[model samples]
Target: MIERLISLWPARTGAAPIVPERSVAGRTLLLLITIMSFLSAVTLGGVVLMQKSAIAWSADVGREVTIQLRPVEGEVMDSNLRSAVSLAESTPGVASARALSIEESQKLLEPWLGSGLDLTAIEIPRLVVVQLSDPAEADIEGLQRNLGAVKGASLDTHAAWRQQLNTMAGTIVFSGLMVLVLIGAATVLAIIFATRGAMATNREIVDVLHYIGASNRFIAGEFQGRFLSIGLQGGLLGAVMALVFFALIGTAAGSMLPSEAGAQVGVLFGRFALGWSGLFGILAVVPVIAALTAITSRTTVRRFLSETS
Candidate 1:
């Protein structure tokens, strides 16, 4: 089977496969390659997840603002909330403004205070959700100042929080890219060492083949075919393992997350899938890794053969 695969590369059938069976050192090298490939795939998955999260965050940020109407001594909270909603609705750039009912606000507190507490006994701020036609056209400062007529009332656009989330996701992607680059460099170095070791171990076999008039291509082809198969096998195993891990993690996290926050976070990563593009990329890795291994093996053999002659 191995002989046939090697023969597919070079048409010349003169010399047999020179590289020995997978030894301890060769298996160890394959295992190390698999681990590195797995890490690289995981880094790629993180980049996708972070990118989706940032985009989801940006979309949420663009649509809405919140106004909090604080309860004051003897002042009517409901009336002030109505006045603020009216002002926001009438504003030129405002799309919609609706105040949350007291019951709805109590539900928001349920996660923190639990169901046992009577929310009515405590003084709380009224929240109004304002949707914008265009955030750029909205005079948010003017709206904030207008709301300030009611003591303790304040406007929060959430711009700072949105900007920070975007920056953080971007930073993660940049760091992941750097990690991927380092992995590629390590892969190259590993291949170089493996190729050198294989040649050194098979030195006597090579000289005997050369004495019998075997061509350089014949010897190099044997090694290249062997390494290429190893690389493809390792790359496939790593990619499959990575895809499964991310999918399982995504499912577990979604199950654990709070309903609302989970919905938002899930929208970004969409249940930890790589989709069509990611699958295609993973498929391409097999060929790419094989090619890299073949090239490295061929080059090492050719250079060493020349030096010996």
Candidate 2:
């Protein structure tokens, strides 16, 4: 099976001996895997960082809840609004609460409702924005009961939204972790397969070396050196390709998102520069994978030769 794959690329194997028979297709495949692995790591790490940012943003502003009040069929709207504000101020777990001014409410709603819409002409429900000393310290049900006592006032908090956001963050974190695991697995698999094939192809060379009294360690070292070189080459090529791909993606994404989000994406991309940990990881893992390949190949080849002899 391996021989057939090598044979498919006749030019690769039939090259002049002086030129050295580097498996171009094999190396290219390794390069592809390397690039994909690195890109996956960088992308997944970015996702984790983005999720952290989103969580912090939510935690910072999640404490506030708005209660809306308006006139019932017979009640006065202004009286109901004032009563709701008073109830909010008196409520426990409430740090500060106030009725939003007409202008303030208009400003908040302006994004969804265009400027042309006359907010004052329509009978809009009066809103009281409440801030809590501790987001979770408030007994929301108790607060709701108190607010319900006020005429035409309804208590509302982002409890459901917060729960959904938490779920999303968890999902993002899990997805990022999965991506890293897959990248590691792919790198290992690629190295294993490439080394196995290279070993099988060079079986005659290895046998001759064994006949000439080359120790197993020496024979392994030669293969190890070749595999290591392949790994290093593949890794460097992959890093470059990943960088270029990231640049293109960043440009495209930046154009689509608003300035703030676009800036965040830029920041994420900038952080993709190979940090010390990343550098150490690639260098260490690639060489270790190569060495593993060499050892596995040598052992398998020795067993095969012995059995055949």
- Give the best candidate by TM-score: 1
**Each prediction's TM-score versus the true structure:** 0.73, 0.65
Please provide, for model 1 over 1-309, each residue's C-alpha lDDT reduced to its tens digit, 9 standing for 90 to 100: 434444454534554347866676579778977887788788887787777767777867877999888888988988888898987887778899999998889888889888867877888888999999998898788888787677768888998988888898889889988998898788888988888888888898788667666778778887888888888888888888888888788887689888987887677677776777666666666676667777887888887788887
Candidate 2, 48-140: lDDT as tens digits: 455755566567558788898865778887777777777777777888888888788787788888776777777777798888888766766
- Ten contiguous residues with the weakest lDDT in model 2: 12-21
Residue clash pairs of candidate 2: none
Q: What global local distance difference test value does model 1 have?
A: 0.80
Model 1 residue 33 CA deviation (Å) reads: 3.1
Clashes of 2: 0
Best by lDDT: 1
